[model samples]
Target: MKTVFITGSSRGLGLEFTKQYLEKGYLVIASCRTPEKAKALHDLKMQYSDTLSLIQLDVTKEKERDRAFDEINEVFDSIDILINNAGIISGDGKNLYNLGDVHKEDFMKVLEINSLAPLLMSEKFLPLLEKVTNAKIINMTSQNGSITQRTQGGKYSYCTSKAALNMITKILSNDLREKEITVLAIQPGWIQTDMGGVNAPLKPAEPISKIIELVETKEIADTGKFLTQEGKELPW
Candidate 1:
């Protein structure tokens, strides 16, 4: 079975990805800030004991990232896919409202997780990815990242972070093209997750399912592109 590693697998889109991938028979290495507290992941672990492995990871910390890498390397020689799914909208006790309400520290914090962490995770796990053929790095970005798509302006922190992530995806794709590793920035659209809110037109399952299909069939030529859940290219 192909192996996949997912960050922030405790909840939201990450949790949904874990569930679907495990059901599809992939060996999943799921990481979160606290695996023990991840009731949903633990429940899945019970059902997919042999196929699932949960590790503790705070994506912002380099040492934790290193540790997770070493731990996974011990059991698996290579990973076929890496999903950079961890992200945040606001920092601890910091507001990310309109211009006057936004905090600089909060902006940096959002960028750190949504933008920097993915790049760091990709770099940290490059060795394992290199060992496999057609390896992929899937960064969970947002349509809000698209310069052409943005008409409103309140979500400064979240929007800017995802935009930075799009750039990282493009740069990584170019750098790793010779290595044959495809990198993509995918927009999940408005779904009924905590971040997406309750009135979203779609649910997590549908979009995530389409995303998995896109991931499974994407080609090297599709690398560096910003894409919707259906795999249509979006303007950066």
Candidate 2:
């Protein structure tokens, strides 16, 4: 079975990805900040004991990331897919991330988790990815990141971070093209997650299912593109 590593597998889209992939018989290495507190992941672990491995990872901290990498490297030969799913939206309760309300500290915090962490994870796991054929790095970005698609602005930090992630995805694709590793920035439309809110038209399951299919089928030719859940290319 192909092995996939997913960050932020404790809940939301990340948890759904873990569930679906495990159901599809893929060996899943799921990481989150607090695995012990991740009741859902632990429950899934009970069912998928042989196939699932949970690791504690903060994603932002280098020491934790290094430890997680070493732990995985010790057992697994390579990882076929890396899903950069960990992200955050920093809000100071009063501010709505509007122009005047956007604080540097909040903006930087969001950037560190949503943008920088993914790049760091990809770099740290490059060796494991390189060992496999058709390896992929899937960055979970947002349509809010699209410069051409932007009509209104409110989520300054989240939007900026995802936009930066899109650029990182493109650059990484170019750099790793010769290595034949596919990289993509995927926008998983509004869904009923904590981030997306309950009023969202779609649910996590359907979008995540489509995303899994996209990951399995997309080729090197599709690298560096910003795509919707259906695998259609989106504007940069």
Candidate 3:
């Protein structure tokens, strides 16, 4: 069975990804910042005990990243897929804000979690990812990242962070091309999740299912593209 590692799997899209991948017979390593508090993830772990491995991970912390890598590497020889799904929107970016009123620390925090952590995780796990023949690194990005599609002005911190993530996806895809690891920045649409909000028209399940399909079917030739959940290529 293929092995997949997912960050932020305590809730939202990450938890859903863990559940579905386990159903598909993949050995899933689901990590969250607080595993003791993740009731939903615990429930899924109980149901899929044999295939699911739960670990505590705080994507922003380098120490935690190294520890998690050591733990996972000891048990799993290789990872066929690594999903960089952890992210955050700062309070200053939660809604429309005056440019001058946005908190500098909060903005930096958002960038650290939403942009830098994924690239760091990819770097730390590249060795394990390289062990598998058809390896992939899926960066959970947003269409808000698209420089060409920017029409609105608010959400400065969130938008710019995602844009940085888009650049990381492109660079990593280029760097890993010879290793046969396909890298993709997937826009999962505005789904009904904690991050996406309740008013979102798209549900998490449909978009996630479609995303898995794209992940499974996409060839190396399709790497480095920013794609929608529906498989449409978006403007970078």
Candidate 4:
């Protein structure tokens, strides 16, 4: 079975990805900030004990990232897929998403978690990724990241963080091109999640299923593209 590593696997899209990937018979190393508190993930672990491995990983912490890397690497020789799904919407843990409303510290926190952490995780896990054939890195970005897609802007930090992530995705793609590793930034759409709000029309399952399909079928040609949940390319 192919081995995959996913960050932020406690709830929302991360949890859903863990469930589906386990069901599909993949060996999944799922990490969250608090594995003990992740009851749903625990339940899934019980159900798919053979295929799922749950670990504690606060992506922003370098020590935890390195520890998780060592632990995971000891068990699995190579990682076929790495899903950098961990991110934050608000810095102060509020709905203060607008430019004027959000504080500078909050904005920096968002950037650290959403933009910097992915790169850090990738850097730490490069050896394992390089060990695998046709390895892929999926950065969960947003359509709001697109410079051209912005019409009515308000989410300064969120938008900017994702935009930075998009750039990182491109850079990684170019750097890893010779290694034949595919790197992509994917917008999973506005779904009915905690960050997406309750009014979101799309649910977690729909977009996640589509995202998995895109991940499964992605090729070298698709690398460095900003793609929708349905695998359609979006403008940067």
> Which candidate tops lDDT?
2
In candidate 1, what are the lDDT values of residues 205-236, reduced to their tens digit?
Answer: 99999999999998787788899999999999
Candidate 4 stretches greater than 4 Å from native? none
Alpha-carbon runs more than 4 Å astray in model 1? 93-97
Error of 1 at 58 (Å): 0.5
lDDT of 1: 0.93
Deviation in Å, model 2, residue 18 alpha carbon: 0.3
Q: Which residue pairs overlap in candidate 2's backbone?
A: none
Write the residue-wise lDDT of candidate 3 on 1-236 in tens digits.
Answer: 99999999998999899989998999999999999999999898889988999999999999999999999999999999999999886644455333866777788888899999999999999999999898999999998899999998777888999999999999999999999999999999998888888999998888999999899998789889999998899999
Candidate 2 lDDT over 82-167, as tens digits, reads 99999876745444478878788878888999999999999999999999889999999999899999999688888889999999
Query: Given candidate 3, what's the lDDT at residue 80?
Result: 95
- lDDT score, candidate 4, position 150: 92
Cα lDDT for residue 11, candidate 2: 93
Candidate 3's displacement at residue 104, Å, is 0.8
Give TM per candidate.
Answer: 0.98, 0.98, 0.97, 0.98
Provide the global lDDT of candidate 4 against the true structure: 0.92
| Global lDDT of each candidate | 0.93, 0.94, 0.92, 0.92
